[model samples]
Target: MSATTLTVRQQLVYEKELCERSFKDFIRLAWPHVDTAEYKHNWHVDVLAEHLQACTDGRITRLLINICPGSAKSLIVNVLFPAWLWAIRPKTRVLSASHSFDLATRDSLKTRRLITSEWFQRRWPIGLRNDQDAKTKFENDSFGAREATPLKSITGNRANFVIIDDPHSVDDAKSAAMRATAVETYLTAVPSRLNDPDRDVIICVMQRLHEGDVSGAILGRPDLDYDHLCIPLFADGVDRPPTSIGWIDPREEGENMFPARYTEKVVRGYRASLGPLQFSGQYQQAPAPDADGFFRREWFHRYEPSALPQHVNYYMTSDHAPSGNNDYNVFRIWAVDHNRALWLVDSFRKRCTMDIALGLSRDANAKTVIAPEGAFALIRKYKPRAWFPENDGTWAAIKSMVSAAMIETKTFVTIDPLPTKGSGDKVGKAVGYQAMAAMGQVHLPVGPIGDEALSEYAMFPAGKRDDQVDADSAIARALEDVIPAWLPIIAPKKKRSMFDDDDSRATSDDCWG
Candidate 1:
């Protein structure tokens, strides 16, 4: 028997083993040396049991499950997993790969010790003449050993079952490159060892890290097949009917989680440690803008009587919405003449297709049209090249475009050029976001033509669908680049000379205080 299992009080662990299909016996049978939490999830165990049975019956093999942390992942794969395998196919050769060799050996040794324990041996004893080799050729003629090595170093498995336990660590989850390394090594090196036709039934469990992590690489390639599951709260990733699934509720459905009295406990931690976004991401799982502090309301408001021209070239940008789900791209053409005055002109928007946008542009007779590159492909058959940033994708283009639209309303206040004064980085960001919140107050023209833009500009429903704002952005960007003189500048007032008091000497005989 291994040292760890001897430490466990049988009175505590074995009490309920006879009552139910004791999972403790399963743990004790597979891994007697190590102690980890164990629980039987009826749904998850059933899926695992069926899959494992298929492997032994020569029907199906090779499986993968992706799950989040804190979902009893270790107990499922680490302890009860090996015991279940041992119970099925006799002397089944198994190889397990994890992120590290030490972690691998620790898990292997624990299982090894369990199979060698008195209780486990009583159930399925290891009886072999060549005991010195540590290989107990079981009654079923199947035998397996544990070896923890780098993913690149698996020489020969000659095993039937293989389990990979999170080959990537938390740090690997962060970096796309590191995750790729772990995945590449596993695919190339580890599987070469198996000898049987049913080679190895491999199962991998890990958290969803980046989009390009090991799980992603394995999943993206058509060479391998995987049943994908994504559940943050549950231990298993198998998609179930939503009628009885999703976030867990402690009380009755719709009953208040919070009573009337404000304890100020949860609010205190929210305010103290993190910014608004950190709370949203860590607690609410909502992603926020990566760049919030750099842009400003005052920077947007460069409008002046001189800033306008008499019937030159100008445009009205609006992010319109047909429904609450997505916004419609809308914009109006304009002109500022040499006399420094403005004139609003034609408008453009469509519920469905660029056919409407093309007709609008052609009717307006605009040569240098500025629009999102995504919408560029549609109308280019008629108009000149619709200009967009040289390097940007659809999503980023949408965000910048919306910020540009808010500038046209003249709701923000600024002088000529942008102001950069007495402040460090933190103070500057605080000031910038403050200005942005203030800019939210501006209301676009409320006509039927502008109704879509106003509603979308207000909330931009569903937190996505920014194409409407993209159309508006095209207008704002064109103006900012063409007329640099239109940018606003906030100047500081001169300080008062309070030191020139009667008692305060400030003459030829200056007082050196």
Candidate 2:
């Protein structure tokens, strides 16, 4: 060969070596039609590639990578990284699994294609063994094997490198049993699949699904000791991994992780499509299911106590649960104006003995106290002008209990059972209140108490403590009876033409006269 040809061949060999040593470079060279061929290089992909390199070098034994959906996580972690591993160490064994067998097989086919590609074969020369050549499971001549299996079907397989792409699907993640099963498999079956317990590599790549999902289960377990790389879709200014881990986020606050692929408009579209809770979990990687759904914070209207109209009727509503491991006893004082706008004045909620609960009720000092069937006894001691107990077929018993309590305390207070109306369910009542609140018909005093109430409203059915919501809903239900009289009806103003006399614009009082 000529001198120029020899130099070109040497440079080509140098480039081949670079590709062999680097996972990203190997991806570019082997799958030029995929990674860098048409797609712009993303920093998150580089980060994932570097982390996988660390895993390959035995710097990290157990790794957990959480990235948003459509961030090319599976393409990088499952397809490129495994193929790159085999390029350098043909003897390395890899066990790849996903939520489903089809997904695992799809990735397996991609990796197989990369391994069998002309570029990869020419550069690395790791030929697949003739006996073990298959789509889902393939072995190289150097005793290395890559097996693709469903997450639940990995019974007696072992590998040096185990890659679980997404152990739970979106639907599977929603189910507690499915999440538990995935975690159990990860804890029990997956660990046993390690050819060497101490030295084998296990990398889990997935989006945040739920608090009880496999990723959560693994992270919660300190004994497992996984190096977590959480790449949220948006940069939220919260430092996820400690600086000691050397995983610095490249994006600034509010910047998209992969803006090249998903534009700001596209991200917003996703947010609109997924809703807040799903978007928070799947995209932002914040699996706070309680914080996002049911009631949005913006829907609430906060006002000063002075904003209450002068002729407002003040009342208190209660949802009672007895002490000793029951739901909290809650009382919310409210005022309804002539315009039928409901204003939350004051509130108290806690798990207390009946004595303290009664003390709380008296301390409220409202004109009327509306209690549920369970709270009639405790609330009667407050001597409210009108005591309305929620009557759901147990009115007589509730009345008897209130009368007995009044007799015992030597104080008589009028008791009236509130008839069940308009789809009598807690959630239904809450939904009604939510509609009113959304229309700016409900207002809350701006303070800590209001903040607490709004927090409960925001959490709703998903929250751990919903006593505040119950109290609010009860008050809303009570207001349905009171608001008809309170709702203002303004007389229609008479219209006048420009040519009409000034007397035509006179007030309705003048017309009545």
Candidate 3:
């Protein structure tokens, strides 16, 4: 057993033993036949290896990794990690899942190939049980098994390690129904597949798709304790997870996450191809879409509260949804400047009772308060100087209601009915103010509220909430009369001196006469 007395094959076996101890090293040893030349290791892979090792060692139970596409997420998490785990602990069981059965099967096949390869066999002689060896599911003689199932069919299977790879496809992620189904499956079905709920580990690896994607749903829950490792295509600020596996991003802000593989030019090309919303959700891992829709962040002028000019007129605009569910009842206080530019001074949005809504409108203290068809009761209770409600077939009913309230409460509520069904569509109204925002005629206060409102505007037509946009549109329509008309100022032709050149000379004084 002396070093000098060891044979060449023995020395090679010793080296393989050392390599098998590390996940990345094992990947180098058992890389698949295709694209072996192009397989390069980055720091992210090393970090993922350490995290996976932690998972195997029972240091962390629930793990979520959100990395950009083309970052070899499946190669590392779905394929190599399972093979390496089985090599280390041959009794371990793993269940792999993806949005589609084909994808899961592909990962299972790659993992099986790695396990059955000559290098793998030489390093750790673990043979698959011939009776149970298959593409979708395979087992080793030591009772270790790896099963691949589509996310929907994940019920009735049990495993020590459950890994979900891309539970939603790009197209499916866009659909509300598909996203909900994915979330539902993960919540209701995936957890039951754990053989030992206390000691078992569940890992989810996917790029963020929608704000309601499975990743979003998990991250949104405060009760769930998961170690989140998010690696964006472009490096944002430092993301140091409070976990046993600590990772600090070395790249500066805006640098490519994997500069060696994805150059700035290549990343830019992908961004252009995917567009802002998809690129932001998929590559950037941002919940909000990039600010590039009908409303641009640059179009908004931000002002500090104290620096706000005395408004020439103030109005409150409201958009209400009575369902008291996901939709918000939004009321925005706006101030019109001497230049006729609309400035959003303050705002409030919530799911509340009619009394609270009335209180909010009364607290706004504007000359006029504009609301849509739904808030007739709020207007009658708060009785501002004027209230314009859309006359969309509910005007007659709303007017009678207001008249009854006036007789009962002895209060006058002015109802200026806005034109319904014509050129005055909701999208048309929003677009009209979008032009105003584009022209830099709209201002917003600089604060958290303003930033949130701006995000809603940026995600317009795609965002879940359009209450604020509808309210702003109502304000824009109400201000149409007061908005200054643009007059083309024509400078009179320059008076020419008598000695001026012939081409430049003009008898301006005589022409006026």
Per candidate, the number of residue pairs that clash is: 21, 0, 0
Per-residue error (Å), model 3, residue 495: 33
CA lDDT, every prediction? 0.44, 0.74, 0.76
Which runs in model 2 stand beyond 4 Å of their true positions? Answer: 1-12, 33-37, 174-180, 209-212, 216-224, 268-272, 287-293, 301-430, 440-513
* Per-prediction TM-score: 0.47, 0.68, 0.80
Cα RMSD to native, each candidate? 14.2, 8.4, 7.5
Please identify which of the two predictions, 1 or 3, would achieve the higher lDDT against the true structure.
Answer: 3
Which structure is stronger by TM-score: 1 or 2?
2
Question: What shift in Å separates residue 475 of candidate 3 from its native position after superposition?
Answer: 3.3
TM-score between model 1 and native: 0.47
Over 1-513, each residue of candidate 2 has an lDDT whose tens digit, in order, gives 444666755766876788777877765555573455466677876788788888877789999988888877898889988888887888899999999989999999988988887766666788888999999999998999999999999877799999999999999986667888899998999989998999999999999877677888888897988998888887878766642248777778878787688898898898789877778778877675444576767767888877777766555676666552657767656677776778876665667764455442332554233343224433443333444456654344345555655655465645444566655566776776777777788888898988888766654553446777766776666666643525354689978678988676367688777
lDDT of 1: 0.44
Candidate achieving the largest lDDT: 3
Better of 2 and 3 by lDDT: 3
